[model samples]
Target chain A: MSSILKKFLMALTGLALVGFLIAHLGGNLYLFLGRDHFDGYAKKLEEMGPLLILAEIVLAGLFLTHLFMALKLTGENQTARGAQGYADNSKNQSTPASRWMWITGLFVMMFLVVHIKMFKFGEREKPITAKGEEIIKAFNGEEAAKQFARESGEHGSLYGLVQKEFKRPAVVGFYVVLMLVLGAHLSHGIASAFQSLGVLRPGWLQCLKPWCVALAWLIALGFALLPVCTFFGIGIN
Target chain B: MNFTLNVWRQKNANDQGRFETYQAKNISPEASFLEMLDVVNNELEAEGKEPIAFDHDCREGICGACGMMISGRAHGPRAATTTCQLYMRNFQDGETLTLEPWRAKAFPLVRDLVVDRSAFDRIIQAGGFISVNTGNAADANALPVPKDNAELAMDAAACIGCGACVAACKNASAMLFVSAKVSHLALLPQGDAERVRRTLNMVKTMDEAGFGNCSNTGACEAECPKSISISNIARLNREYARAKLLS
Candidate 1:
């Protein structure tokens, strides 16, 4: 495919990921609504059954496409530099985020794996609560999973899983660091994606860059606040 | 004024380059950077030593021919000035400066401080001209070109095909150069007929020549001798996308 096409795909996937982050942050903010609301939100997702699975599949595809395109583009860029190393590469004018995008992206991917593992496998050593194990044992089939979902009292317990996950200082610290890196990446990325897709005017970028930086910080702070607040028992049960 | 120069020297494209230090003693502070090299070359030639080879056509900056990384900045510490226009007075009396050729895969080293930038020529040849026959000169304002477009086109047209943007770019991208060529033609009424094809062909040629993709890093704009703005690059991207969408 053409390089421009690859760039377009990268930008398209990036914009989609940014959209996903907004939805995710909004959903996670339901934690502030107290345990029942957050737990019901989680239960509602499982209740969607095949639809939720399909959406996750689409999200995974977007993530993979974004990753592959980035690797291919970065490889081409490095090769275009040829076999010489600059004696004073410091002179190249660029933002630190733009220069370090690949490294930050790889770290974000690593964090995603750990994050999904937290949800799917119940937080490594947190010891799934007896209520969680009872639900799992009680619901062996698809019909029972739905029946379990209808019983809101029984389903009100998954928030315990989130509470345990975020209450750990190590998990919270690592999550905060990754969120900061994500912010750095997005600060450059939001405007950069538009420029790459050829939709952004250069004159608009100056006005947009500050806004992109602010949005990045907002997303980072929003995601980070949960674990930080939870770890300090500020609104923790 | 005297200066210490660390000049890069390589026998050919296949050979590894190394820095060769020379003392340019008793040099005039008024001499241009290239002229200082000329005096140093004279001394080397008199001693039966091979003078360091470098590229130069017009000692004036407009030709876009004479260029080298002086002290890691394109065309020396003076911003917006070509190596040929850079004067020795810009350097401190006893300061050391390093000189090297444009280091992009698209512009391979010829020797010493010279690089073959014909990759740019091929990109120009790809679509830098309008093919329509006007046969003879029309009345001065026959085309009725818009003033702002003419000015923007002039800004892009000011590019002299220098590879400084590529040299300064960490990715060694040629986006600024290709964009200049595309925008210059695409902005003109005379070029309207082939605007779409021209953008596609020139950009394809640039990529085929192994130039890197623009990361929107702004390095090219920072170090361009002509002070070519990256807005032209934005235009190129827009044109390239428009072409693909229509195609």
Candidate 2:
């Protein structure tokens, strides 16, 4: 693709990913509402099997589009030669936004692979417990009464798996870090996507960078807080 | 005062280069960095040795003729200043200063501290001008540009075709240089006749020439003697968008 077209694809894919994050965060926040509500939400999503597949396909397409554009541009940037000397326009223009694109994009891609393996493909099916005794053993410190306190009536569902995962501090911490990286990536990616697409105008664009970064943090934090809160037995009921 | 210099020396573009150290004694603190180099060069010349070759035309910084990486910085420690404008006072006595030509694939080393940056010229040639034939232009008053646009154009036009933007960039991308040209010409009515075509062709040439993509880090602006804003990059994006869509 042409550089401009590639840039546009990057912008569009980035925007799509941001949109997905907002929706995903919203769904994940149902955990705060109550266990029954959250489990039902998960069940509904799982039931939309074909639709979820379609969403996944769309996401994959976007990722491929964004990745290809970056690769093409990176290649093109490698060959040109130019006249020597200090041009007035070039001094001290480097920014973090420009330098870390490939690094962060690659990091995010790596994270996404693991993220999909763990969350999307693995967890989508019925809760795959090694054994009931293993769950009980993992929760060994707590008696059966305490372990069953939240699950009470519902144990073999998505909510039970979530409660189990959150009970592990390591799992909660892992997600918190992941969310932070996601937030940082989204922060830079959002406004830049607009600029790439030609929708962003000067004068008005300044306000968008901070706002986008903040919104990204908020979304990531929203997803992260529940895992942490639930693990600590603070917000989970 | 005494200082140590780790200067990169190469006979030509194909020659293997390495850092050669030279210790200076009784150096004046008032001398500019280039002047300090001159003292060293004069000593080398006296000793019947080849003087270190670097590019420098106007010692007054406007020429954009001198840019070297000093201790990992494009133009030394000073912010928004070129090497020509740098003075020796910023350095402490006995400090070691490492100088090298801008290290990027696009910039081929021609000799010690001098790299061929002709890639920038190719990008300009691709489409960095307003095509107006001599003695055929309309009255300047015929075009009433917004005050802000005119000022911004002048700001972009301030670029002196220096490769400092390429040097300062981590990717060695020349987007800042190319964008300034695209934005400056596109800003005026006389240039509007080919704005879309100009932006597209120049940027296409820039990419074809192997300049890395712009990450918008603003390091180029910080190192620029002219203090050119990264805003010109945004304008370039706008121009590219229009050119892509309308043309």
Candidate 3:
């Protein structure tokens, strides 16, 4: 395929991933509304059944395609530069975020693996409340938490798990750092994706960079806020 | 003014290049960057040593022949200025300067501070022209071109094929140069006949030459001596997509 086509695919998949991030951030922000609202939202997603699985499949496809194109293009770009490099190379107008995209992208991918492991497949302990402890004791411990959750029309104790995870200084610190890396990736990726797909014009060019950066940081700040607030007991009871 | 020069020196393509320091003494601050190099070469010749080899033509900066990375910048520290037009007055006395050639897989080093940029000529040969019958020039008002398009075409046409865009690019991508050539012709009525074929063929040729893909860093536009806008790159992408869809 032509280099432009490769970049076009990269841009398409990248933009799709950005859409997923926005939606995911919006849903995750329901945590601030307390345990019932957050767990109910999770339950509603699970209630989609096969449709939720299909959505997950599509999201996975987009992320894999984006990763594939990034690796292929990055390898080609490195080879195209030849073996001998400059003695003292310096950037003229590129930002740090733009120049270090590959590194930031790889870091985000690694962060995603840890994130999914922690949230999706990890243990969800019962909430630390008087009624919650009594229910756990009466239902015969941690395994009954899911049964109780289903009976009560919720998605287990996911809110409690999130609160427990964020209460750890190390976990909160890791989440915040990864969110910043994600922001750096998006700062370049958003504007670059538009340029790659030929969606920008000369008139929009002046405002595009700043707007992209602002939007990227805003999303990062939104995600980062959840962990920080949870760590400080702002949204926890 | 006097300066220290650490210039890349290589006998040939097979030679392992290295930076060699030379002292430029009693240089005039009014001299252009190339003229200062000429003074150093004269001194080397007087001392019965090999002088530095570089490229230059029409030192007025229009010919696109003279270029080198001066202290890590494509054309010294001046914006929209080529090496031949960059005067020594911009630098302080006793400053140390480093010079290197444009390095890319498509641009093989030929000698000291000179690389073969014929890859650009090949890209041009692919489709950088309009096909018309051999006859007298057409009347200026015969074909009406919109004022905005004409100005935009002129902006793209200002590109001098200097290869500075590649030098400035972190990936050594030539998207800016190729886009300028593509845009200058594609924006005109005379180029409408073969626009699809031209965009496809030129892009294919550019890829086959081993140039990297554009990452939209804007460094090319920032360091372009002609100040060629990256808007040309966006236009090139649109043209390429349109051609792909049409065919």
Candidate 4:
């Protein structure tokens, strides 16, 4: 395929992922409303059953397509630059974020793997309610966990898992750092995606540039907030 | 002003290039960058050595022939100025300058500080012109071109095909150069006849020439001697998409 078409696919998938990030951050922010509200939201998503699986499939498709195009283009670009580079080449106008997009993108992908493993396939203990803990202390094994969840009138405790994970300083620190990397990636990616799609005019880009950066940080900080707040005992009680 | 020059000296495409330092002694600050190089070349020739080889033409910055990486900047440190137009006064008296040719897979080195930029000519030949019958120029104002379009076309047409955009880009992408050519013609009525074919053919030729894809870093615009806006790139993208959809 042509280079333009490759870039066009990259832009479309990237924008779609940005949309997913916005929605994911919105849903995750329910954690601030305390355990019930947050767990209830998780339960609602779980209740979607096959539809949720289908959504996950589509989201995965978008992410993989974006990743594929990024790798393909980066390799081609490197080859096109030739083997003998300039001895003292310096950047005139390209930003650090723009130049190091492939690095940041790769970091984000690694973070996603660890993130999904930690949250989606992580431990699902009994809810941390007083009665639930009492039941857990009173009994043992998976039956007691299910009994406690049923008695507490709650689904599996995603909120409890989130609190457990964020309480770790290492986990919180990892999340905060990766969130910043994500912000850096989006800083260039958002505006670049629009430019690639040819939807944004040059005049509009002057104003849109800052907004794109702001939106990038906004989403990153929003996702980072949950871990930091949970670690500081803000939403834990 | 005396300056230290560390210039890339490549005998040919197969030669492994290396930097050789030469002292430019007692040069006038009023001379253009090319003139300073000429002085150094003259000194070398006087010393029974082959003078440094570079490219130049009109020497007025309009021909797009003279260009080099001066101290890591395409066309030196001046914005919107070509090397031929960049005066020596911009640098410190004792400053050390490094000069290198435009390095890209599509641009092979021919000699010291001179690379073959005929890839650009090939791209132009692909579709950078309008196809009209052989005749006298059309009467002025015969085909009504909007004022905004005419001005924008003129702005895009200001591109001199200097290859500075390629020199400056991290990917060495020529999107800016190709876009300027594509936009200049695509924006006019005469170019309207082959607009679709022109955009497709030019972009295809650019890709086939081993130019990297543009990542919208804006480096090309920053270093462009003509101050060609990346808006032309955006227009090129739009034109390509429109043509693709229609075709």
Best by lDDT: 4
Clash number for candidate 1: 0
lDDT of each: 0.85, 0.74, 0.89, 0.90
- Please write out the lDDT profile of model 2 over residues A97-182, one tens digit for every residue: 45567767777788788667765545421333335445666777366634444344333456656776677878788888877777
Per-residue lDDT tens digits of candidate 2, residues B95-141?
98888788767778889998887888888787787666635565876
lDDT of 3 at A101: 88
Q: How displaced is residue B189 in candidate 3, in Å? A: 0.5
lDDT of 4 by residue, A1-237 (tens): 888888899999999999999999999988888878988899899999999999999999999999998999999999888998888866567898999999999999999999999999997645556666666666764675755555574445888788789999999999999999999999999999888888777697787989999999999999988899999987654
RMSD of model 1 against the true structure: 5.3
Give lDDT tens digits, candidate 1, residues B31-135: 999999999999999999999898888888899989988878888877889988989988899999888888988898888988999999999899899998856
Tell me how far the alpha carbon of residue B107 in candidate 4 is from the true structure, in angstroms, after superposition. Answer: 0.3
Question: Between 3 and 4, whose lDDT is larger?
Answer: 4
Residue B214 lDDT (model 1): 82
Please provide, for model 4 over B1-247, each residue's C-alpha lDDT reduced to its tens digit, 9 standing for 90 to 100. 9999999998999998899999998989999999999999999999999899999999999999999998888998989999999999999999999998998999989999999999999999999997776368778887799999998999999999999999888888999999999989988888888999988998999999999999999999999999999988878888989999988
Candidates ranked, most accurate by lDDT first: 4, 3, 1, 2
Candidate 3 per-residue lDDT, tens place, A52-83, comes to 99999999999998888888989999998899
Off by over 4 Å in 3: A126-155
Name the 10 consecutive residues with the lowest summed lDDT in model 2 chain A: A81-90
